[model samples]
Target: MVSELCFSDLPAEAGQGWPRGGEMVGITLEVQALQSYSLDPHYAKGLHAWFLSQVEQTHPRLSAYLHDGESEKPFTLSRLMGPFREQGGRQVIPPNTPFQWSITGLNPEVVDWLWGWSQRLPAWLELRGSPLQIRGWKVLFPPRTYSQLLEQAPSSGSCSLSFVSPTSFRHRGHHLPLPVPKNLFHSYLRRWNDFSGLPIEVDLFLDWVDREVTIQRYRLESVKTTAGRQGSVTGFIGCIQLAASPRMPELLRQQVQALLQFAPYCGTGHKTTFGLGQTRLGWLAAERVSTPRASQEEQIAERIQELSTLFLSQRQRQGGSRAEKTAWLWATILARRESGESLEVIAKDLEMPYETVKTYAKLARRATKNYQSV
Candidate 1:
């Protein structure tokens, strides 16, 4: 079943003194109905990993931030889902199946970055170590407005949301984490309030403190994530409809709706970069949605390819295959520095000597400066 929820451009800064275009705004782009040649239940996870590699290949800066978010995540990815035929209880997306995927940029720079790549539609997506041609793309541009969440609450004084993919949390608990209403909404609210580049009103803050949740209907099952050195992400997937308690203050209600509207774009919970925590609003207001397609810059794809090749060659020359291992590490350190992540955190995550990571960061900065100068 297909349902649509729309969010418009909401401007947010990339953090203190980050370089960007004058008008900072958050924009989300979705490429829907990508068809593959064969059935693969694991295609979504493969696509997720391929996306990370592609980002690292094209925009190391963004890749680094996604790896090390010192401030807020500049972007989030949702898991791709589509109808699949079952074989011996295994889910297999049929050959020539149409699947949809999206990327949400939290800052104008990210949005502009995505806009540049939109021109090269119907590109090859690597899945299961093979190049799969995405038949075509239906691009959603200009982003939709998320103002419906501000409408007056129903007389029942409640709202509901649906989860279409595996959604989980990182807070330590031995048992599988059930999606709690308050915690879920609070999670979205915190991200929205922290990264949306908007100030929260006093009432909204109070509502966050006072609100509650009731899970109406749900079907949850654990799903393992893509294979990687990071191991696997085991999370829950199902449909859940939650309602707010004590009614909700007007401002609080709107803020919640707004954030929920944007949640699908900025997926909730961990491993989003690897296609975990894909979510969406169950219902939406009746409004005519429209998108503006930006004209593609000429030779942009060629330019991205050129940059990717240069970086790959540089890394290969620096340490051969060994240097490739640290490509993500250096990018993480450099990206985190801009977002305010401390050296200690980066070292721990990369499992490297703190001083060594620092030195690499310095070298990475110098290299970037040199590249730009040339």
Candidate 2:
């Protein structure tokens, strides 16, 4: 049913005029579901896997770096944005329904790789077992180098950003849902430092950011969601207006403006690659409204958090990271099992040994029973 010409089958000139050679770029792919299918709440994980697989097919080394790099990730992905119906705790997309998915690359290597990949894009994006026919694609954010962003930043003005997807920061081993200005800039600054090759003094910049930047107004709502392999996240989706004090040095103000521009391409906070922290310029009032189906994942995440808290309190050795991780792991295993997921499937998803997951599930049961009996 895909009548459009595949990218590979097109003339070479068709790929021309597309943004290339920039240090950062963002693109949105328009796709339509070929058949009706139900998706898990955490289906962003599948998108993440599919992307890495595409990179691995041609540039295995780059894929390895993207997957294993300890540095700030040079890319981010957005969850599919479109209409869906909630059915039996899952999201169901009808056949031929259109969706938009965005990807951004922050470094020259990634940008170049994205450029090359886009030239020969596959006809379909395989999510779980469903195939979404790629309809068309376009650049979402203009391609620009860090220097260009710095040079082109407005000399003085307020900036507003919309967090289109749940955005959160990791603070002291827990999720911080509020977008405190210090944390917000620190998030963008981290990525800017990692990939820009133009390093700014962190303490100096962040100090200025904290002292100079003030939140003018905000409309935010917190939501619970699952991210990455094992744990749930509590994050915010909304918009905030920020401005620097006029008395601040002009250069520092420009840097602040530049970082705000970088936000859409670099994303705002943690787990961005797994669909958190999707951001864009401007105050998007419509996105602040919540949908009923969006709460399905929140419900599951809340349950996991509740179970984890209960298990953590029961641990005698609750002071260290080990205990915290164990509690969360146990809580996740038990929660999924309660949701009718088989132990084998849960173990595979969590990448834990089968016996270890089995044992954790048993331990979690005992802990719950003890608490209830008390």
Candidate 3:
């Protein structure tokens, strides 16, 4: 059973920015396995910290598992995903307005424990060291079941996605700075492998790639990271349609649907703790695209990847590791240029010479044209 609860009459500023370092726009809760519960806002106010501390005191084993999980020794849980809501129907929550937190868990024990906790809700919910009275809360359970999901799952190997929040990944030792088709699906497959508790074969999942999945109509943009003063997150935040090869197995296609549902809750990439990667199913070619539109910068990032790939393939202008570094640098600049970022801003952010970025942008454009004409 999944229950959803809503809390209103929160401090407006709390919604604008809570959990100061979280650097998130809306409210979200990262509680594990509560059948379904809703929490009100703020991390900056130490509210989340207090709540977790209480959990630690009351349920040390469960709390420890959620904070950090290890298979052996100190045994903790690492698969902690959260619930969040930024909009209610057509109306978007205004900044500093009250926000809602949706809590859910598949485990009945987790749900029972959480539901008990909510029953003991104090009269006042504290924020940033200030206490505010709870307006009201009601348990809600909408129809969400395995069968319902099965009905909604895509019948074909093809899938479309919309990254509602910044979605990035880690490839090799570095953050995958771009949303490539391989990285995106591989990340999904990895998460499913980790949490699905199913005996899925890695080769079988990889085989889906051999079917030649293609990505199209994507938009990406960079979001500021609150982790550090200069840190930023580059992620895709628009519609991307993926077409699978006909050779894809029916089982794999079914898995794709489950993966899509999982992506929204589990998120897609690194720094999900700070709310970086969020996604959902997107417009198939046949469906009318929704109204929440992509930004101009996002649209440019979509095409910029194709342009960058084209540029690199043609010139091989530089070779070796050093050459690879140069190619990435140029690709970064070209992407930003296409997104309409000023060379000066790009230079300052990348700590490069303005003239150099301008020159590289021009070269990239030329390379793109050269590749296209051929």
Q: What is the clash count of model 3?
A: 10
Return the clash pairs for model 3, or none.
Answer: 12-96, 19-43, 19-44, 34-111, 35-111, 45-128, 65-77, 69-76, 69-77, 70-76
Number of the candidate with higher TM-score, 1 or 2: 2
Candidate 3 local lDDT, 277-326, one digit each (tens): 54556542312122122243334444444554565566545445555555
Candidate with the greatest TM-score versus the true structure: 2
Please, what is the TM-score per model? Answer: 0.56, 0.93, 0.51
Q: Please give the lDDT score at residue 67 for candidate 2.
A: 86
TM-score, structure 3 vs. true: 0.51
> Candidate 1, residues 103-125: lDDT per residue as tens digits?
66655556656555544433566
Error of 1 at 336 (Å): 31
Clashes of each: 4, 0, 10
Order of candidates by TM-score, top first?
2, 1, 3
Q: How well does model 1 score by local distance difference test?
A: 0.50
Q: Assess the local accuracy of residue 219 in candidate 2 as a C-alpha lDDT between 0 and 100.
A: 90
Q: Which regions of candidate 1 are displaced past 4 Å?
A: 1-46, 56-60, 83-94, 139-156, 173-176, 199-211, 216-234, 283-374
